[model samples]
Target: MTDSSSSPITVRYTCPHCDAVHSIDRAPDLADRSVTKHSQPGWEYATPDDDLEVRETADGIAFICGEDGPVTDLEGKQIEGCGRPFYLNFVRFEQGVELDPNPATYGGPRFDFNG
Candidate 1:
């Protein structure tokens, strides 16, 4: 069964040659857009010659190099310059709550005058 409590909020890039994996965390809703922009010039410096393949499943997305054999990211495409097939996988989720900071005393309970 899938974990409905939370959704994947990160993308992991794994290099086939070097076996190195890089993880990028983002808001769950923004993951798709973030992955798509990686191929853009200003976003990741990927050249038109660089073959980029993207696959999306119900859970997440994957980006792989279409070229045969090993590939290198010497241009710093947000990944290490590893000579191998580059794979980007997004499948892990983090569950948590974001709360605003309180300015009350450190050891005291919060109080509301309106209450």
Candidate 2:
């Protein structure tokens, strides 16, 4: 990933099916949250608005095509891209390592519910 302590970190990849170039800008601090305490190198979440759910790891990142349907530009015009799920593998040492789907879970909740 590009280094920048304050600026947004941009991740770029090519679509597998359509070969379209895509870029995602993430907060610089996102790198810090990418890894779990258990050392599992990744993070997964759905956007609060329920669009663009993605899973990212040291090995790679996977994105659901168009979130729900065709992706749109800031003006709401549809941008051309294959509406299919795709994975981008981060090649390391000439190989791509896959992460375990289930990593060690963090110990339950921080506060007691009965309070």
Candidate 3:
């Protein structure tokens, strides 16, 4: 049942038993999405299970959500799911809004990749 036929689509859920991984493409709405807590800070983590979701499902691999954009209250925590710490460059946006995963600029993003 899992193959190219199910490519580009896979069910996703955290194991209720032990936070294990769970995936299935054709579930009967039992695992339907409800608002889930953003799990990261600042994003207001959609606590009740309502909202749109974009996800990927595979074995042993858990979700690492950007949660609308980035996690807040970093207080030194790795920016949730990306293993990145907060940088001061992004202090302007309304906290959790993004056109893309990373920061964007009118012309292009400025990165310190050269060094």
lDDT of each: 0.36, 0.43, 0.28
List, residue by residue over 7-110, the lDDT tens digit for candidate 1.
Answer: 54644444444534445443354423222212222122322233222222222333344332233344435433333334232333437542222332124467
RMSD of each candidate relative to the true structure: 15.8, 13.8, 14.9
Please list all clashing residue pairs in model 3, or write none if there are none. 34-49, 34-50, 35-48, 35-49, 35-50, 36-49, 38-45, 41-72
What TM-scores do the predictions have? 0.23, 0.36, 0.19
Question: Can you list the residue pairs that collide in candidate 2?
Answer: none
Q: Candidate 2, residues 1-115: lDDT per residue as tens digits?
A: 4443456556544455555455665444343212222222354343213322232224445555455334544444557666665654332332455333333333543543685
Off by over 4 Å in 1: 1-7, 11-13, 25-55, 58-79, 88-115
Give the Å shift of residue 86 in candidate 1. 3.2
lDDT tens per residue, model 3, 1-115: 1233333344444422223233333313222222122222232222112222321121112233333233323242334343322211112234654323233323545676775
Q: On a 0 to 100 scale, what is the lDDT of residue 110 in model 2?
A: 54
| Deviation from native of the Cα of residue 85 in model 1, angstroms | 3.3
Worst 10 residues of 3 by lDDT: 52-61
In model 2, the runs with Cα more than 4 Å from the true position are 1-6, 26-58, 68-78, 91-115
